[model samples]
Target chain A: MSVVELARPIEKARATPKGPRRRVTAWHRWLSPLALLVVWQIASATGLLPERLLAAPADIASTAVELTQAGTLPTAIGVSLQRVLIGFLVGGTAGIVLALVAGLSRAGENAVDPIMQALRALPFFGLIPLFILWFGIGEEPKILLVALAVSFPLYLNTFSGIRGVDGKLAEVATTLKLSRGQLIRHIVLPGALPQTLVGLRQALGVAWLALIVAEQVNATTGLGYMINDAREFLRTDVIVVGLLVYSALGLATDAIVRLLERRALAWRRGFLA
Target chain B: MATRLSGVARAFGDRVVLDSLDLVLGDGEFTALLGRSGSGKSTLLRALAGLDHEVTGTIDVTGSVAVAFQEPRLVPWKRLLANITLGLDAPVTKAKEALAEVGLAERADAWPLTLSGGEAQRASLARALVREPELLLLDEPFSALDALTRITVHQLVLELWARHRPAVLLVTHDVDEALLLADRVLVLDEGRIAHDVSITAGRPRHREDPELVALRTTLLAALGVSPEGRS
Candidate 1:
């Protein structure tokens, strides 16, 4: 039989529609959320929902624009972005290095994996009080906190990814007379990459969470600091705007990782959805 | 001689898989090894391929060896052409030529996951052939293919073998496939070659030939199957 004949069934299965063919436009997803925002705005304008409790969407938007023009919001965002970038770099590098050491050799795994597993068991956020005492309320502790939170997911995933490489492929490499370095470069690392990217996505998510919590506790200037300063003045509009910015940053970073996944894992398209 | 194995023995725990086996293949010879389930056919092939280091004996191959396994185990991350040239230190043009030979020239840049089973098997064959191996070990490579695809691949393998003149050792369970392809058919029993027969007939030998019909019955009886379609 021709290759096309053999592949036709799989193609048909994938092409078959599972449900109703009604086309749902992209904006349909936002319909309910937009309606809720409208209801909240009407309530705020009618004085039913007090400004002390929460800011209306319109008020939050105006506050965001005002802060942007005044350069306060931009500065806060810059500081927060810098902290996450530095922390992620440090933690990401450490995680990958450790995973390589542990995953590649038996001696490395024996020396490193036990300690890592032990350390990973502890709730990382619980280290905040101890961190503040040790590093003071400086950028050291804040950046370190984000680094700590970011490292575990990457280390765990990368280690498992490396370990999970197919033994069959390794055998094939051996039969092909691949040198030691070539075997690792061509087979093991590439095999491990899909899982490593998954770890990256997870690490990024936790990095942002760690930064927000760290800034909340003892930040002199950042989005978290701005929110804290607004709390004293009861500026709910500014607080709402800061919260929105934090979520937007998280979503934007996630989208970037998704794009990277698409590019790196293009080979996986026909194998799975 | 292309390859020789003397007193090669392998055992997993108390179960002996290969019991002091001795075999030889002439240069550019096509040999088919047949065995029932658990008859150590794969063990012997693995030993010759130098993949089973625990096989206690001497396995001397004159030159390079390559294997195309049943699964066509291509690295999923690599394109077809890259898979063919993996670790071979060959130019892209050589790999492209091999792809063209396998009728996969247009799929050189395709991901392995996207290829159908037959196409992937052909790519696997290209990968092995690109090495220009002196001994090509095929471990049931065509067993997973449909009958028509198997026939096509069988033809392709014969064509490649003719052109490259590589000594081929095909491990298979199909009696017809062995009779159709090999210069010699060997049946393994009790971890040793129990039946070794030579097919001296010319190329494109007829399955319905009186001599082949007689040989088939003899081989079937040797495999402990009755000629009357009984067990």
Candidate 2:
């Protein structure tokens, strides 16, 4: 019998008992968050909570609809997304390329790694003043800020991932007589991919953070610009809407990475869900 | 001869592992090497497999050499069939045939991590056999298996070896395992072959047979273990 066939009965047996209990726990997981939202809504309706400090959920929802209909929200989303995408592409590419250069050869490591390590130690946000002075308060500084923020996580993860590839597998490659390029392609890079994906996820997160920080400074567009405009007008509802959009975008990107992980790492059986 | 090593010397800093070790392997011959824990069994095997180059020696092999390590060493990312065909220009049918030979045909699409220990080892063997090596080096591949699985795999290996006629050198610690599977057994000690014995018994030989039992005692003695369990 096939191994899968042999394993079927046991899997069915374990799954049956866990199925209903899992559903119960999944619902329970959302209970606290839902309860908090209800309480906040009630407090807003009863006038126990003031709108200036925090807008009610109903107010935030209505503001979200108004902004969406007025085309402001959509435009801001589009602008912010473009910034992140371009920055991510630039930074992610640079990170992977640098990681490959350092990971693949001793000379590459000696030439590139020490400088990267030193640069990584400086707080990335601290570079904003220097960036503004260097590149001006245009899209250049904003995008470059995001790119710089995104690159380090990817570089660190991909580099370590390449180094962490099993040496035994490398020996197997040698025995199989794989060429140096083939060895890197088949053994090194694929083995390093899981960590690189981790780096990608972190970079995406940091890209959004960097965009927000960069936008807060002398900005003309994007969600941060919308929030800055909302603050001058004391529109707590609009500010909350902008923050909610940022969080939703973050969650959406994370979900994309999770989907990619599921597809790419399906070979890793028994990994936690 | 399939392989020959002359005056092979290997040392790890000050400690000598293989001191002037000389050995020869006949074509299609099955040899079992036994040794105490630190007796350079793996060192010699690694040297022959071309994995260790620091050794000073004249070593020659007739054709391709394939090694199956103790852990199977199948790339965990690759499927069973892909792993078998790794680095080879062979067609998919050849890898499929090799998997079938190892009794893992149905698991050709399965990931390496999903396989049981025995199944993984069989896949390792399939990988080695697919190359059709002139020399097959097994570095204690079966030691990680449970007893029942080990016996089954032992039979499977013998069957494959019989068909392929590869010059097989199996490095193992078990005395009975060596006697059961090998035509010739060599005991390694302190960096050299301390003793060599030929097993002339027929196929499907029993452990209880007077000849094998006597040879086992002698082999055990050569490995510095008393037959009666006394020091």
Q: iRMS of every model, one decimal?
A: 0.7, 1.3
Candidate 1, B1-231: lDDT as tens digits: 568888889999999988888888989999999988899999999888888889998889999999999999999999988899999888999999999999999999999999999999999999999999999999999989999999999999999999999999999998888999999999998888899999887778789877677878888888888779854
Model 1 gets an lDDT of: 0.91
Model 2 stretches with alpha carbons more than 4 Å out: A1-18, A270-273
- lDDT string, candidate 1, A1-273, tens digits: 233534345434544536443124334668999999999999999999999999888989999999999999999999999999999999999998999999999999998899999999989889999999999999999999889888899999999999999999998998899998999899989989999999999999999999999999999999999999999999999999999999999999988997898788788876764
Off by over 4 Å in 1: A1-25
Cand. 1 TM to true fold: 0.94
Candidate 2, B1-107: lDDT as tens digits: 66999999999999998989889999999999999998999999999888997989899988999999999998988888989988999999999999999999999
Q: Would candidate 1 be rated incorrect, acceptable, medium or high by CAPRI criteria?
A: high
lDDT of each: 0.91, 0.92
Best by DockQ: 1
The digit string of per-residue lDDT tens for model 2 on A113-164 reads 9989999999988999999899998899899889999999999999999999
Error of 1 at B207 (Å): 0.9
